[model samples]
Target chain A: MTTNHTNHRTNSSGPPLIQCRRLTKTYKKGDNTITPLQELDLDVPTGDFLALMGPSGSGKTTLLNLIAGIDRPSGGNLIIGGTDISTLSRSKLADWRSVNVGYVFQLYNLVPVLTAYENVELPLLLHSMSAKDRHEKVQTAMQLVGIADRHDHYPRQLSGGQEQRVAIARAIVTDPTIIVGDEPTGDLDQESAQAIMDLMVQLCEDLGKTLIIVTHDAKSAAYAKRTLHLEKGRLIEAAVLAARRAPLVPQEA
Target chain B: MRLLPFAYAVRNLGRSPSRLFLSVAGAAMVVLLILVAGGFVNGMSRALRATGGEHNVILMGAGSEESVERSEIEAGVPGVLAASVAGVRTRAGVAYVSPEVHVMLPVRVGAAARTTTQSSGEQAAAAQGSNTASMSKPKGRQVMMRGVTPTAALVHESVSLTEGRWPVSGADEVLVGRMAATVLGVAEIDVQVGKAVMIDGRPWEVVGRFSAPGTVVEAEVWLPLADLMTATKRETISCVVLTLDPYNEETGEGADFGDIAAFTKTRPDLELVPMTEREYYGKLANFFGPIKIVAWVTAGLIAVGGLFGGLNTMYAAFASRIRELGTLQSIGYRRLAIVWSMIQESTLATAAGGLIACAVGVFMLDGLAVRFSMGAFGLMIDETVIGLGLLTGLALGVVGALPPAIRCLKPTIPVALKAV
Candidate 1:
């Protein structure tokens, strides 16, 4: 699944799915103003698996949020899927994101009261999909993440790994073009982290979907096709990583 | 967008069950207090208004209703005026006018004596002995007895015989309302069938027991005017009640009692002041106006406190869920929708509180009698009290919810997102 996403990114012609030129975000605290993201330039090509790595306060999450249209850049351009998201109104950007992007948070923000299936079906509520289609899509996403049997289990009832899988299902349930994860495996144990990362990479490669993961873990960064390092609100390096030790090619291929 | 805010709000509340319970309980207490206070005021007003004596207009001797106890006129004035009044409604050509005398007297039961020597020592001796025995024989029980003719029943529509028939002409029979009978610890047969009660040490045969339309009349005892006058032995007349001639529509028909009083002032033969039963009760209500005002003021102040408590709960609830609200906003829910959802939450909470209070109030307090003098009228909780209580709940929901909702929606997305 990972190889197919790398193949699509290597093949797409016109531009990257996410393009940021001189992006800056500033926060005012009392009398002092702090710049979180300063003149950062990055491009995330379609169907690419990119991992952003940085220390705390390095604006790694800010950059990912800007690309996902979850937060606005104080200055400069952010174009995601051909739309200048930085210039779009909050409401308009929200609409754009629901259709084009899905978010997976570190804490697995799965409304604890709702079952795995319902949590995965949350984002689809904004869409015009029929209930049957939504149900099928959610079921397929759950099955793909291998948590189909746990669909009725609440997040509190599931293991950290299973919950993250449900979170991943939710992220990709809409079949969004880009899936953004802010430390998706940060809260999981080693085995759970590996299982979640494996499922995520499988979904990316198998589904031809772009995945951006923000993480400080080198082992987690090792799974991505591209690793972008951020320092003090600016991109320090952008490079393609060596493929996972096990080649992602299907058994038939 | 539609589900996110509510989802988060509900989830956030669920996350901290203790806080949610505390807030809901606090809100419920406030709502309950408002409901009870509102019910109390309503009950008092109904009780006072109920004393209108069923549309019977009392004509005082050239003074006010408050002054009626001190005022007097010729005993034969009612009969003479009944014959001459221009608009008196008649049944079989007999004017439905009856002269009545009202006086408050101290009544005692069992061994309690009202004599000055016995009363002075009674309090000290009773206090030294058992309190229950002293309480059982209440000292100087103030009972308002009305001296009335048989026609008094016609004038006061609420009067009804539950036992023996109305006093036979010239018979020494007395009737009492149900509440009065209950308070006096005498059954309908004791007051109605053929028993007798003491009036100034004279035993008057009880002829009938009656129930009035409202609670105030229930506290009164009725006796034949001549017998009551004979028992007391010094009465001229307290007041005269007369109906106007029904045929003289132009001159006296539909004449307001106040206007009739003014017209009567011009005549030298009679010095009378007239007022409708309602107006008379209104004047009586004036006596308790200050007490009512104080009650309302206290309730209003407490209500404001309760409102603040409710507002605080809602504000805290909304504030803690800013992240969820931002999530909704980012998912395309309008600011108005978020605001509306918060309002709905508040309304729902307060409405639940109101319903609890109402159920508690109805089950425990409805038809509960609270007897206090509002001048001549005696005010209890009734249907009106319940209606006001429910209305108060609705008003609390509206007034307490709107302000916080507006504040919640005013913050921009970036600010709201950062709130968490």
Candidate 2:
């Protein structure tokens, strides 16, 4: 599917922003080895809105988590913005993720005890910015997400949509280069899900953030500029699924 | 790097109020136990040391250095010492040598008074050998009886009459020390001036009350020496106390410690040992030193137990917050930073408990008297004790929380985030 806002304001003239070359992730569970993502190759350019669609156990979230740097790939070179993050130390990866990647969870994983403002301010606390500067950034981020008035409300006090908006505010407060979402609107109502997708579209088109969303909903995927389908930890052509789902042409008698 | 906000750690305590309360209460108990134990040692040591005076000398049986109460000397020893020691101080032309008899007579409160106070476990054990005063109930609490001569007033200047007059010379009158009731674990009204105490099956009226603050003497019941001797049919006395002449270096006529030591050495027939009052009390203090150490050790062991309890609670508490910790780590907080925040939360809980413990100890435990074999002493919760309590609380917090905090945060971000 093609996005309506194809023209972005921020600079997009660059090589692929994220490159995954044979990215693999394997783990052991009680002597049973499990490979979630095996030898996967992918590239996401700057200012691109990409959606990943797959069935259960298809490793969509695993790929998203690896891209977000919360999980490391096994036996692969995963490079983002000219840095081979697979080779970086754990602490160095965390630092890199803090500055370059903003992540949103399906459940809108806001700390229940923290107010919306404090939740939005969490990412900027990693920087050496002054309090005033952090406050301004948090305010701007909350304002951009159109939830500034609900800043003091805790996650439990806010609706699911409002909480997800706070989570998005927290994501962009640091002004990260890439935003990764795992089932971002999975738990929301249809209207709220559409609203969140529209917000993501706006973030990519206006602010030039590279967005990679993992979802199973076709309506959600329609909002992205390009969509990829995966099955059994390996990427497959979307045209194949479209062709299968397309109605058979009938001969006129 | 930036630290985790203080507000986060503090406000998170409200998440589990019962858990927070239990942690705080446990910490407070440990701190209070330490304070009470330390105060006991301090008060007992001070009481023992304060019993001795610099200018007084004690003469007891040669072999009974451990207990003056058990020491026995000839009745004429005081007179012989008075005549032999020339430099002894004379007041109003009379020598200041006092003959004293220390007897541990089993005493019981009056029948009317017995119903008002309950005997402690120790006193009940002591009352086992005695007969019931009324045949309807057990006898009142048992106590130690001290028999002293009139000259004792001059030798121990700390003794001051607080209520009523001193016991008559040859009568069955007795005077109770202010802390005697506490030592006996009886009601204060049971040992007041108007009360009567039965000693050796004979009733002696409480003619007066005396106080010797901060000394073991405050735990004794003082009676006439002649009366106690006649009643118990004892011809021998316990010890002889004497006031020394102020030492004059130039004239060399006043009583010198060297002269007293020589006197004890020359008199082989007397079979007497001479020691300064300070030296006697110093021996008593040393005798109780092991007890002080035992109190501290018990408190330390309990504190260690409290530490493990705190650690377990923290483990569960921090384990439940694994996802929150993962969130912090994913937001770029280092493992050590999260560990520090956990420590801050534990420390804040313990420190709050410490403050409460200190206030409770000072108000409830301080000046509370405890009785032992030798005498009774009040608890001393001074600055040192308070400081010790705080240090214990802080240590409990740090040592207890560190391991759990580190263990909870040990997992990688994805693994921790996966925790429910």
Among the numbered candidates, top DockQ falls to 2
Query: What is the DockQ (computed on Cα atoms) for candidate 2?
Result: 0.54
For residue A22, give model 2's deviation from the true position in Å: 2.7
Tell me each candidate's i-RMS in Å.
3.4, 1.3
Residue A139 alpha-carbon offset, candidate 1, angstroms: 2.0
Q: On a 0 to 100 scale, what is the lDDT of residue B53 in model 2?
A: 71
Model 1 spans > 4 angstroms off:
A1-12, A238-253, B1-29, B32-56, B65-67, B92-94, B108-138, B164-174, B181-208, B226-233, B245-266, B286-293, B315-339, B375-420
- Model 1 has a DockQ score of 0.26
Off by over 4 Å in 2: A1-13, A239-253, B86-96, B110-142, B243-259
- Tens-place lDDT digits, model 1, residues A1-253: 1111112223357788887777889988899998878876667787789999877988888888778777788998888778898888767777887788878878776666678988888778878878899899999999999999997898889988888889888888888999989899999999899888998898899999999999988899999998876667766533332332346887784
Lowest lDDT 10-residue stretch of candidate 2 chain B: B113-122
Model 1, span B1-420: residue lDDT tens? 444436544555565666556555655666566555655566556656766654357787765557566768788778766755555667886677878888776544333443433544566676766455435544545677788877877777666777776765456666766766445543334454566555664345667777765546777778777776777775589888765433345563643454456556766577777777666766766776787778778877877888887777777767776765665564445666667666656665666666776677667755544445421222234466556656666676667767876777677654565565
Winning candidate number (lDDT): 2
In order of appearance, the predictions have TM-scores of: 0.81, 0.89
